[model samples]
Target: MTSISASEGCEKGLAPGHFAPETAYLDTASAGLPPAEAVTAITSALTAASRGTATVGGYFEAAADARARFARLVGVAPGRVAISASAAVHTGLIAQSLPAGSEVLVADGDFASLVNPFHVRPDLRVRTVPLERLADGVRPGTALVAVSAVQSADGRLADLDRIAAAARAHGARTLVDASQSAGWLPLDAGAYDFTLVVGYKWLLAPKGTSFLVVPEDLGGLTPVFAGWVAGEDPWGSCYGQVTRLADCARRFDETPAFFSYVGARHSLALVEELGVERIGRHDVALADRFRAGLADLGRTPVPAPGSAIVAVPGLGTAAGRLAAAGVRVSSRAGGLRAAFHLYNTAADVDRLLEVIAGT
Candidate 1:
């Protein structure tokens, strides 16, 4: 359980000046504050659009840059990554690819976007198991084992290596929703058959930007949602039927949200510059500091060792008070959930503890 001191984290690129001076934001799991660079990029894009100087090619290039950065972050080739609007969009595509009556194993109480898509398809058999038991739930009949790498309600991390191995042993594919883990956790997206990440949260990008990584063979998923962006020559295929789709995972691409991608490109650059391992150590240090403070206050948080999210039971009711005190956090599953990122500090952890102690 190594950690980076707040000062060390700042040196590594946690620019506190980019955030509001008065607020202690501990809710990255909900949405991250975009860095100054990302904000500038977004504003520039908007200005260019308003001036009628924005080109479609520029937007496409921005998206391509973002896609490659994300692939690098997750240890995959850019050709294996598909630009997406949301994790649900990719989840639905995976669901559509499943044969009728295929068994889909999912973690109970996982994020709705990851679980609902499978449930919506009545033809599929969806089974729910506890996150801890998800690996054991994989069976001979399981077509896919879908779970979040990090639980949103609580900070429970799935045993991804074990689950992936079990799925492989059972002849099933694995789909991992990394929305909660990507920026602050080191993830090898290539280990799973499908890995989906939404950039608005930990990646510190704008909404409407996400990424999906699939196996080299495309993991048997059909590009049912593909539009002009999925074409081998996107501009050329804009009007009529696509004469040829992309040979790689780009064939599954959703039309890029230009403004979001424009911002995402710069945001992901910051992440790469700082490195995920450094961010994770900084984040976990802050979370551990908070956990220790809560223990001294006679409050117990859900046990999550080495995690960047701390969920304290019975403190959900204190969220409004904390928010009023300028400490931003989230209330979920009847608890107060505070997520730490590279930007968080020891002072932020102390402020949260002081408010909770008062409440």
Candidate 2:
């Protein structure tokens, strides 16, 4: 392990420079380091819970606040924000909103959690569109095309604009699993040609936490209807009084993981303070530096030059040996493997390159 760090400066407060193992952290494309603030948020919530202050009342209020933070980050309305325990849960709600016979399309090899729901549902038909064959065909009955913005395996950035426009032309709804691209990309829901996309990964937010942004004027998609507090109508009514689901993205059921919400909110707050585009700019610059450093090895970049993830191909048999050393990069289906996120530094990249070169 080696010592190195990065930091952000904000008004009214100045965060100290971070220090973590440079040799150890390139693997964070696997799981990132939790922010100091997020850790504090969780501790504070647990403290409140221990003190009998984790009330149902406070939970809803915090949920609404979380909704606003997340909505602003993703460029959507608080009402459009549906607090889902997982991106798949958000997709399940979208599935229910559309017709039963809907056909959906997506990358064949995405993180499994995103694909399992459609496969399990008998009424819905799902198709795997290999990156090469993405333009193949969409039948008339195709209702939704579920895709990951940046596929987990090779880290290819999905062309959201193209896919969104295609779905619009075909009259099919688009469900982009923005899981891995959230913290890495500049995703404005308002700017999104695609109406619905949920952020999960790369955001450094907790697992099982995601935000879904649906279009503004679609007439009553479907009611997610899974929140107990939501049933009570957060505006001021009791549960039974409000039988209707939320009109915006909140239509999906959301469990009040107040602690996780606080953690995520803190992360978003940091992202906002530091600036999303700024964070992304830094990430891309780091990746380009890493890629350039690999020139001696005749390596090539991944399919798309995405921010959160980057690859150095041509490792061949050397790749397996590198993993045994506890370097922590998992393989994608294709020959390419990748590294990601802000926890990484130039030193980490050099070490990975050193491993490959030494091999």
Candidate 3:
């Protein structure tokens, strides 16, 4: 991994007046703290909307800009991206797009949204494999593979390049859930037939801001529920004109939360300005520091493939203890999950270790 300069790392820390003086937020895997600029953008948009100063054209202009930025970040064409409400919604769409009776393989440690879509369909088959044994589970008969870029439970990184190659050899499509890795890790959406991204986690945006990437090679995806925004001539079809739907992924767009898109636009800009590679290095280094600190407390971290998240036993107890001391963390996957993001620092890790050691 490349090293981030100390000055750059410090610049990535929490913005001024963003958090309480004594608080250390370490649960970024669940929901990121929005940047101050994003908050301001959201409030400004909401104010305009309530005052009837926001126009439909202006709302969609911002949405289009957001989609373009997301496309640039993921290395895909803007037309291949569709603004979505959440990951669960896109998971179901991809599951339904596949032929009936297709085999969908998912890792046991993946988020529930990856598996539940296929589970509810009687015509489709869903199977679970251990996170460590995911590649071995793919076979010729498999029709689709769904997994997270970073396992939500333990922060184990998935080898998407390897998995995509294996799936392609077996004539299967791959749908990657990038919710856990998007803003910090490099992602090439063009490599997969489908990719789901949610903004609240690493993107440092609020809920209601998410998107799906669907390449043309995957074929037309039937909208599970076509709203007024589903066709090429969206406004024209409002009066029952019976227009054709779009050939691109935009056909699947839902009526988005305009204010959320405004905030997401600014958040994406921040990540772009910082450069995802630099943020990745900063986050991994902090995670390493946190793991080393836990080791000093005589606690061993659960082994994971990457440095995005560090899990150790007694997570529930540790979370309570840390909370009592005004430090925030999450208990997940049978351990204390301390997810590191760009906002984290060595000082935060030191504080967590001090609490854990009862010092």
Total clashing residue pairs per candidate? 0, 5, 1
Candidate 2 lDDT over 1-359, as tens digits, reads 12222222211112234324323344445555556777787788789889987776666566677678777778777766667677666666666666677787877787676677777788888888775455445556677777777776666787777777777778766777776667767777664423333333455555556676766763345664555455535555344455665555555646656676767766666666666666665566666666776666777767567455765555545556667654556555544355545555555556667787777
Deviating ranges (above 4 Å) for candidate 1? 1-7, 10-13
Cα lDDT of model 1 by residue, 277-337, tens digit: 8788788878888988998999999988888999998789889999999999999999999
Ordering by TM-score: 1, 3, 2
Candidate 2: C-alpha lDDT = 0.62
Q: Candidate 3's residue-wise lDDT over 267-318, tens digit each?
A: 8888777777787877887887777777777888877745578888666667
**TM-score of each model, in listed order:** 0.97, 0.82, 0.93
Query: Local distance difference test, per candidate?
Result: 0.90, 0.62, 0.81
**Colliding residue pairs in candidate 3:** 315-336
Query: Top lDDT: which candidate number?
Result: 1
TM-score of 1: 0.97
Q: Which regions of candidate 2 deviate over 4 angstroms?
A: 1-23, 191-200, 217-220, 232-242, 312-328, 334-336
User: How does model 1 fare in lDDT?
Assistant: 0.90
Q: Which is the winner by lDDT between candidate 1 and candidate 2?
A: 1
